[model samples]
Target: MTVRPLNSVFIGGRQIGANCLRVLVDMDAPPQLVIPDPDDVGVDSWFESLVKVAKELSLPTLRGARVKDESAIKKIRALKPDIIFCIGSMQLIPKEVLAIPPLGVVNIHPALLPKYRGRYSTAHAIFNGEKETGATLHFMDERIDSGPIIMQEAFPIGNEDTARVVYDKFTEVGTALFKRFVESLKRGEEIASTPQDESKATYYPKGLPSGGKMDPSWDEVTKKRFVLAMTFPPFPMPDID
Candidate 1:
């Protein structure tokens, strides 16, 4: 079996990021260089701790998380990876770095593109009473979650489901797409990607809607989904008036 001659690099932290790295290694693609979540390195982050163990167990990794920082950008540019897979990156990757890779950057988002685009995607889905939400794997560009679609899979949302449940389901589907996407490239299969329609696009900002506010007049179903989506114990409830 002939594998594609592609040198991939990973820029992400935590679940989706870690999962992508695992796929890269399992496929025997190459000895990848991982730039862990910047906040994880010096903090008490389990994500960082797991990365450290991977390195100690001999997983080739480099430390980087901020794409906007000059020094970190410089280090990444020097590596010249063919493709950069980003997941769970807090900082938006600048165009300067995006142009450095041969295949460019691709990110996995929890919501289907051109519909729910932004940080609180899953929550927005629940709050707005969306019946169906899915995952999207797309090529990254200058805009936020406004990238061409590489692969997408949709899953139904239970009327009584919470945000984490939506997240867990999407993560399962998205990770599978990630695996198939990489393998398709290795096998030289054509990836049919399509441009997103901006007219149908809707953008939601990070954090709470109406700037940390919620409507008390909403029905029980709406309120239930909102609370479930936004509030998890050990984490404080969202500030509402």
Candidate 2:
């Protein structure tokens, strides 16, 4: 059987990098090369995990990279991949890199997007007391997650669900949805996607306030919501003086 070609994958960020890598390998839809980001916490570890898997299949270690800024783009251009899959990595692809891929670039964001187009989507969902959240696979544009949606997999945000739990579920559903999407492509199926509603779109800047004063005077429901949102570990419980 002829394996489908997926070109190169630019992976980093938290679980997005590892989960995408895992699914690609599992579905045999892995790219010709992988651009790893060691700067991201545990990203290199994800690469190492895949390295072992690659060796077992008699494949070379996926390309390892640590450079940043223009130098990194130059190196990527030199590699000449036909498609670029962005899993994470804060670096944005310029027009020069986008031109190299006929398929353009595809990325997966951990929110129902068109809603959460920027950073801290998971935490935002918890903070806002959302009852539903999801992950989106879409084309990459100069704007954030404002691209056309290739697919989206949604999961319930239980009243008790923590941000960490929601994040994990996003990866779980995202990987499964991504596999189906890629398989359809390999079978010569045309992709059908609807443009995101710009009117409903929202963007979150990085370092959005994760913690604030936790007032004991607040109602029980509001206090619980605050705890749910801030308990994700990175945002410490507000210091009570």
Global lDDT scores for all candidate models? 0.76, 0.69
The estimated TM-scores of all candidates read 0.89, 0.81
Candidate 1 per-residue lDDT, tens place, 79-116, comes to: 78878888766668899888988787989888988899
lDDT of 2 by residue, 33-149 (tens): 655554433223422344444444444333445434566667677777766777755556666666766777888888998998888788777777789999899988777788899
Candidate 2 TM-score, C-alpha based: 0.81
Q: Each candidate: how many clashes?
A: 0, 0
